[model samples]
Target: MENKNIIITGTSRGIGFELALQFADAGHQVLAISRKMPKSLMEHSNITCLSIDISDENEMEQVEKFVKDSWSNKVDVLINNAGLLVNKPFEQLTTSDFEQVYKVNVFAVAALTQVCIPFMKKGSHVVTISSMGGIQGSMKFPGLAAYSSSKGAVITLFELLAEEYKESGIAFNVLALGAVNTEMLQEAFPGYEAPLSAKEMANYIFDFSLNGNKYYNGKVLQVSSTTP
Candidate 1:
């Protein structure tokens, strides 16, 4: 495969971090965005680390400018991997909690995609990382009302976008991930061992982001070996 310009959010750690490294190792030019910058990502010659809160409009504009100025207004792949999860019971969850989770998980995905679409051409793929909890009829979890609902919202959002942009040939898809042994997972399910590690899940996402579009568009693939 030819080297392509890729943008991935939430690269500070976990699956996002692994994805950044994997893409860079594969000779892709990567723009890694996260609220916190990891030194390892910065040290990579093939990766550019941007420390910014994706929920902030100003910070998102900076990403647009960087793409326009540095990437020659071209983006081959965009991975919306940043997510915020608030583990609180529905009764205890405050409005602020919902806003915070939605800001990062749902709104930020839409905001970043809106800005990057113009730079993408035919064959470009936009992959949004979601959670299995978001899928209807899937096993529901407690204390994930905000997080799971936000994930579900993005799934529908991208499905709509895929159809709207079908003529443009830019593929949009969502991957509803199951339990992965990441920090986030630890927070949600303490002491429960996940069958998959961060690196393992990242490898799957890395390959899907590159080639899944050829077979699917506006589709949600449940990428889990076990139920959450």
Candidate 2:
């Protein structure tokens, strides 16, 4: 494949950083957006790490400006991987928890997409990462009601967007992945061991974000191990 312009959120570490590294290694220019730019991502010539919190609605304008001014007003692949996971039972969750989680997981995805889609054209791809917990009975965990629900909202947003932008030839997809060994997963489930590592999950996610839309758009792909 030819070199493509890519944008990824939550690139400070874990799957997001791994995805950026994988893409940069393959010669693609990646705009890595996170709260802070780590030296790991900064060292890559093909990677430009933007320090911005996607959850903050106002910060999205910075991304738009950077894309237009620095990288030209063109983006081939947009990945919404930044998310907030608030682990709490439905009964203990307050409205504030819902607001915070939804802001990062759902609203941020929608906001960033809105800002970036203007620069994208036909053949562009948008991939938003969701979780298996978002799917009913997919990961039967006690806590995380708010987090799971927020992820579900992300899946719905992209599904509608795919239909609305089908004529534009822009593909939109959701990857409802199972637990991966990341700090976020560890925080959510203290001692539970995830079946997949961040690197393994990043390989799958990076590939799908790059090419899975060739066959279909607006599909929520459930990625998990066969064994429970």
Candidate 3:
């Protein structure tokens, strides 16, 4: 990953935070984006923090322009790790909740990718963070209809994008994370126990990014700490 420049969304906390740190530790220049800035992240020469809401088109475009201008048309990776979740029975979920989740979880990923695509050089990997629920619905869970549906849409978009760019040297894949201890999950399941920590999930994602290959392109991987 030498000379790689990574733009990671949702970096204020959780797996996004850890991923940004890992990328910086690996000596790759990282552009960390989040709606709110983290007060405690240690300043690093390789890391540049940008405040931008993934759902905000104008702000995201500003990020794109900054990357293009600063890096000279080189965006090594675009990680769509921002997401939203609202748990409630399908009937209890409001139309506003559905629209909100879709805007950030699905639309932002697509829009941000499109903004970065023109400047992405060869061998760039586009990784989107989805969830296990996207692959197989969890019948036992409540209020995940909108979230799961949005993640499923992201997976489908990644697959289509991979097919479209297969001959163009860019790779696309979705990491369908399972039960990571992030604030989003905490909001959905107030008393739920998390099976994995955000740092652990972030490590797995960084490792997966390092192993990019055409064979794994278009695939959705279920990442769990206890899984083989």
Candidate 4:
């Protein structure tokens, strides 16, 4: 993976940060995009941090252009790892919450993937960060409709993208995480315990990215602490 150009979103912190560091440690040139860059990551030699909001259309265009021009229009791997969550009853959930969640989780992924398709070479991979709530109904939780539905849509997007790009040699998949001890989770469910660390989740994603196969493409992987 040395010299490979990898692009990841939401790298300011949490799982995205861990993934960026892991790839950089492995000698890959990383382009980390987020709204902000942590001071600790400013000194990473292998990483180039770009501050851009994925939810903004114009910013996304600029990011796409910068990536293409700087990287010679080539991206080895693209990871759509940015997401949002809102908790409240249906009646209490405002319209802005729905729009914001969908914009970040669903719209951004679709737009970025579409723009990245032409830049990706054969054997390149795209990974989306989804949630286990995407697979099953989250009746136990309140006000998860917007988030869960967006994840479900993300899974569907990956399915269509995998089939559409089958001959193109660009693999696409979604990692449906159970509970990662990330800020997003903490913000959504305060006091949640026994969650996976960003490094643990990053490792899982790293392995999958290296070993992506036909069977995994378009498939939603439900990651949890206990599995059969």
Report lDDT (CA) for all predictions.
0.95, 0.88, 0.83, 0.84
Q: Which candidate achieves the best TM-score against the true structure?
A: 1
Question: Where does candidate 3 clash, by residue pair?
Answer: 88-143
User: For candidate 4, lDDT tens digit of each residue in 1-228?
Assistant: 357888899898999999999988888888898999987566898898888888987787876787778889988889999888887788888889999999999999998888788899887889899987787653335668899889999999899989988888888988888877888887767887645788898999877876665456777777777321
Better of 1 and 4 by TM-score: 1
C-alpha lDDT of candidate 3 relative to the true structure: 0.83
The superposed Cα distance between candidate 1 and the true structure at residue 116, in angstroms, equals 0.3
Summarize candidate 1's per-residue lDDT along 83-172 as a digit string, tens digits. 998998899999999999999999889999999999999999999999999998999999999999999999999999999999999999
Which scores greater on TM-score, model 2 or model 4? Answer: 2
For all candidates, the clash counts are 0, 0, 1, 0
What are the models' TM-scores? 0.99, 0.96, 0.93, 0.93
**TM-score order of candidates, top first:** 1, 2, 4, 3
Tens digit per residue, CA lDDT, model 3, 1-228:
366888898888899999998888889988888887676544877888888778878778788778767888788888999888888899888889998999999999999999888888667889999987788654335678899899889999999999998887888999887777788888877776688889988888887776665458888887754421
lDDT for each residue of candidate 2 in 1-228, tens digit (9 for 90 to 100): 889999999888889989999999999999999997889899999999889878888989998998899878999999999888888878999999999999999998999999988899888999999988777667567788888888888888999999999999899998888878888988888887888898999999878877887977999989877313
Q: Answer with 1 or 2, whichever has the higher TM-score.
A: 1
Worst 10 residues of 3 by lDDT: 134-143
Model 2, residue 30: what's the lDDT? 96
RMSD of 4: 2.1
Residue 103 displacement in candidate 2 (angstroms): 0.3
> Which candidate gets the maximum lDDT versus the true structure?
1
